[model samples]
Target: MVLAIAGIFIVFCSVILIAVSDRHPDATEGISSVPISIISPFQDAVTGSITFITGIWRHYFYLVSTAKENDELKKMLSQAVEKKNQCIEIELSNQRLRKFLDFQKTRMAQTVSAEVIGKDPSPWSKTVIIDKGRSDGIRKGCPVVVPDGITGQVVSVSTYYSKVLLIIDRNSAVDALVQRSRARGIIRGMSAEDCTFHYVLRKNDIRVGDEVISSGIDGVYPKGLRIGYVSGVIRRNSGIFQEVDVTPHVDFEKLEEVIVFITPAEYEFEMP
Candidate 1:
C-alpha cells in the first residue's frame, strides 16, 4: 500500500512540472502572441496619429508663408506701375518741348515763350491769361501762336501778366485767303469753335479741306500763317457772296503754352 501511494504522488508532481515548463515550441509561441496582438494595434494607432498631426502642422505653416510672399509680390507690382506712369509722363513732356523749340527755330520773327495761366471769367469773351506781360516784351496786338497754328492776340497787358483774345471770340476777325484759289475773305468768329468766312465771291472756287492762311493785309498776323481750313461752303443765287465755314487749326481748350511774336513799334502802329 505504501509503494502505491508514493507512485501516485510522483505522478501528480510530474503533471504539475509539465504544465509549468516551456518545453513545446508551439505552446511557447501561442502564449507570447496574446500580448503582442493587443499591443501592436495600439502602437500602430499612436504612430499614425502622430504622423497625421505632424503633417497638418507643416501644411499650415506652408500656407502662411505662401500668403505672405503673394502680398509682397503685389506690392512690388503696384510700385512698378506707378513708376511706369511717371516715365510716360516725362516722355510726353519732352516731346512737347522739342516741338516748341523746333517751331521757334523755323520762324523768322522774334518770339517769347508764355505759359497759359488762367482763362477768362466772362462766358462771352474767349480769352486766356498768359504768364508774360510788358515786362516780358508782351504787348497789345501781339500775335500768339503754337506749332499747329495761330491761337490768339494779346488784347490787354499788365506788369506781369497779359490777356489774350482768342481768335474764336465773336469780336475777333482775321483777313484770310484760300490757299487753293487765292480767294480773299474775312474770317469772323461767331462762336467759340466756329468761324464764318465772309465776303468770298460766289464765283471763287472754295472747297472743303482748303487751307486758309493769313493774307498779311490786316497788318496784324504774318503772311501765310495757318488760320484754319474750309469745312463748308454755301452759295445762293440771290446773294453776291458765298458763305464759308472754317475749322481752326488750334484747339483752344487744349492750349498749354504759346509763342508771342514781339512786333516792332511800326508794325504795332500799323495794326488797326
Candidate 2:
C-alpha cells in the first residue's frame, strides 16, 4: 500500500509541474515552486542508491583481478626456486667429477668410474650397489677406491649393476703396513667406522697417529695406497701380537662415486 501511494504521488506531482510550467512560460513564481520542493528529496535518494550499487560492483571486480595477479606471482616464484636448486646440484656434481679426473691422472691402474646407486638394507652387512657391472668390466673381487682411499671390493655382479662389500664389513681384509715404522699387519673390518689391525707384533714400534697403507702382498690393493691411521693400540704381557684399532681414510657415509680397477687379479699397480 505504501509503494502504490508513493507511485501515485510521483505521477500527480509530475502532471502538476508540467501544467503549471505550460501556463506561465516566464513565471517561476507561485505553484511551480511548491511541487519542485516536494519531489526533490525522493529524486536525491534514488540517485544515491544507484551510485552505491555501482561502486560495490566496481570494487568486487577489482578484488578479483588482484587475487588472480597474486596467484600468478606465487607460481612464478616457485618455478624460480626449483631452477636455482637444480643449478646448485649440477655445480656440486661437476666438482666431484673434477676430483675424479685428477685421481685418474695420478694413478697407474686402469679404472672405470661408477656411481653409487643403492645400499644394502641389512645392518649386519655393509655393502653398496654401483651402476657398473660385468658389461663395464666390473667383476667379482674388483677393488673399489675413491680419491681418498679404499672403499670396498665388488663381490657380486649383474649385467648393469654390482654389489660391493665395503671395507667395514666383517668379511673384508687387506694387508696393511704402518707407514712410520714399517710394521706389518692385516687390517680386518670390525665395525661401520673402525677396523682391527691384526698380527702386529707387540715388540713393534707402532703408536697412535701412525698412517697405514696397503702392502700389496695379498695381490688385491695396490702398494702404498693409503688405508687408514692407527687410532688405538693395546699390548698384552703374554701375547706376541698387539690389539690395534684403525680408522679408514674413506668416509663411507659420504661415498658417492668410486673407481673400479679393471686390471687382472695379479696385476696390482702402485699409487703415487
Candidate 3:
C-alpha cells in the first residue's frame, strides 16, 4: 500500500509540471493578469520617454537655427538702412551742386568756385571758410558772391582755404547805391544780418523796402550787384545822415558755396 501511494504522488507532481509548462500565453495572462498589465505600462513608459527625448532634441535644434537666421536678418536690415541714408545724402548734395553751377553761368568775371567749410569761431566775428586757396586766385579783399547777391570778401587766404568776412561783419563796408533815387552811399556792417546805409543824406528818400546795390565806386565789387535792402530808416537821431537799417541779401548762416569774382580787367586780358 505504501509503494502504490508513492507512485501516485510522483505521477501527480509530473502532471502539475506539464500543465504549468505547456500553458497558452492567454491562459497565463488570465491566470496572473498583473504581469500583462505591467508589460503595457512599461511599454507606454518607454514610448513616452522616447517621445519626450525626440521632442526636446527637435525643439533645441529649431531654436538654434532660428536664432542664427534672426542674427543674419538683423545684419541685412542694418546694411539696407545705411544704404538708404547714403542715397538720400547723395541726392541732396547733387541738388546743391546744380544750383551752384547756375550761379556760375550768369557772371562775366573769371570765377573761382569754393565750398563753405566753416563758420565764425568767435561770436563777434561773422566769417566763413571757403575751400579755395591762394592757388585758385582767391585773395584777400576779393569779393564773394552768390546767385542772389554779394556775400562777402576774402579776408585771409592760405594754401587750401580762404576766410570770407561776411557782409554782416563789423568791419565790412560796401559802396551801395539806392535803387530808386540813384543815390550813392557807404553801407557799414554792424551786427549779424544787419547793416546801415551811410550817406543817405535825407531820410524821406530812403524809405522802408528800398533796394541797395553795389555802386562800383569803391572798385572792390562790380556795379549793380545786390547787397541788401533797407528794412527801416531811423530818422529820430536827426543827424546830417540818416541811419537806415538793412538786412543782407544773403543768409550767411545757410551759406554753402560762393564765387570769387575775378575782375573784368584780369579775366578778359588773361584769355589766351
Candidate 4:
C-alpha cells in the first residue's frame, strides 16, 4: 500500500508540471531565470576574491625584486668610494716623491734614498731606522737629510738596515751660524722638538726669526744646510752666554723618507 501511494504522488507532480508548461509554452526559460539570478551573485563574489589574491601576489614579488636590486647598487657604491680614496692617497705620495727627487738633483753630495721603517724603542733616544744598510753602501756616520733640512746621522748599521741618530737627541750637536748676523753658535738637541743655541755671547745681534745654517767647520754636515730658525732669545746681564731656543725645520714625527749622504759616492738613487 505504501509503494502504491508514493508512485501515485510522483506521477501526479509530473502531470502538473506538464500542464503548466503547456499553458505558458516558454516555461523552461521562465523557470530557470529565478535560480540564475540567485547563483550569479555567488559566482561574481568568487571571481573578485581570486583577482584580489592574484594582485597581492604580484605586488609582493615586485617588492622583493626591487629590494635585491637596491642592495646590489649600495654595495657597488661603497666599493667605488673606497677606490677613490686609494687613488687620492697614491697621488699625494707621488707628489712627495717628486719633490724629494728635485732636492736630490740640486744637492752637490752623493746621496742614496732610504725609507724610514722604524723608530728607536728607547724613550730617551730620538732615533729612527732606515731600510738601507751595509749592503747598500750605507755606513756609520752617514749624514741623513730630507728636502726640508738635515735629519740626523747614521750611528749603527746592519746588512739590511741602519739606525739614524736624530739631531734632536740630547747627545747630538751641530756647528751652526746665524744667516743674518753671521754669529756662531752650537746647535744642541735639548728635546725631541727643540734645540738650543749654545755659546752665543750676550752682545751678539742674534734675534728671533733668524735662520741658522750649518757652519761646515766641523767637517760633518755640508755648508749652507739649514738647521733651524731662532724661536726664542733670552739675554742675561750676568752670564757670558745667552739662552736661545731653536725650532727644527724638519718635523721628525712626520718623517717618511730621507736621503743618506754615503761616503766615496757621488750619484743619486731612489729608495726601493
Give each model's whole-structure lDDT: 0.79, 0.80, 0.75, 0.80
Q: What is the C-alpha RMSD of each candidate to the true structure, in Å?
A: 43.8, 38.1, 42.2, 41.6
Clashing pairs for predicted structure model 4, backbone only? none
Error of 3 at 247 (Å): 0.8
Model 3, which residues run further than 4 Å from truth?
1-107, 264-272
lDDT of 1 by residue, 25-83 (tens): 23443454354344444544564576578878877768968788889999999999999
lDDT of 4 at 207: 88
Among residues 3 or more apart in sequence or in different chains, the pairs in candidate 1 whose N, CA or C atoms overlap within 3 Å are: none
Evaluated against the true structure, the overall lDDT of model 2 is 0.80
Question: Per-candidate TM vs. native?
Answer: 0.58, 0.58, 0.57, 0.57
How would you encode candidate 2's per-residue C-alpha lDDT over 1-272 as one tens digit per residue?
A: 99999999999998897787557533543343353334433444554576578778877768968788889999998999999999899878875775656533223577999877666668888988777777888777788999899888887666666778888888789999999999999999975789999999998999999999999888878888899999999998898999999999999997878999988334323344
Cα deviation of 70 in candidate 1 (Å)? 32
Q: Model 3, 68: alpha-carbon shift in Å?
A: 43
Compose the digit string of candidate 4's lDDT tens values, residues 2-41. 9999999999999998788657534653454354345434
> 38 in model 1: Cα distance from truth in Å?
99
Instruction: Kindly report which residue stretches of model 2 are placed more than 4 angstroms away from their true locations once superposed.
Output: 1-107, 264-272
Model 3, 1-272: lDDT tens per residue? 99999999999988886687456323442333343234434444554576678879888868969888989999999999999999999978865775655532233678888777566658887887676767787766789999879898876666556668888888778999989988778888876678988887864487788889999888789888998888998776566777788887887777876888855322222211
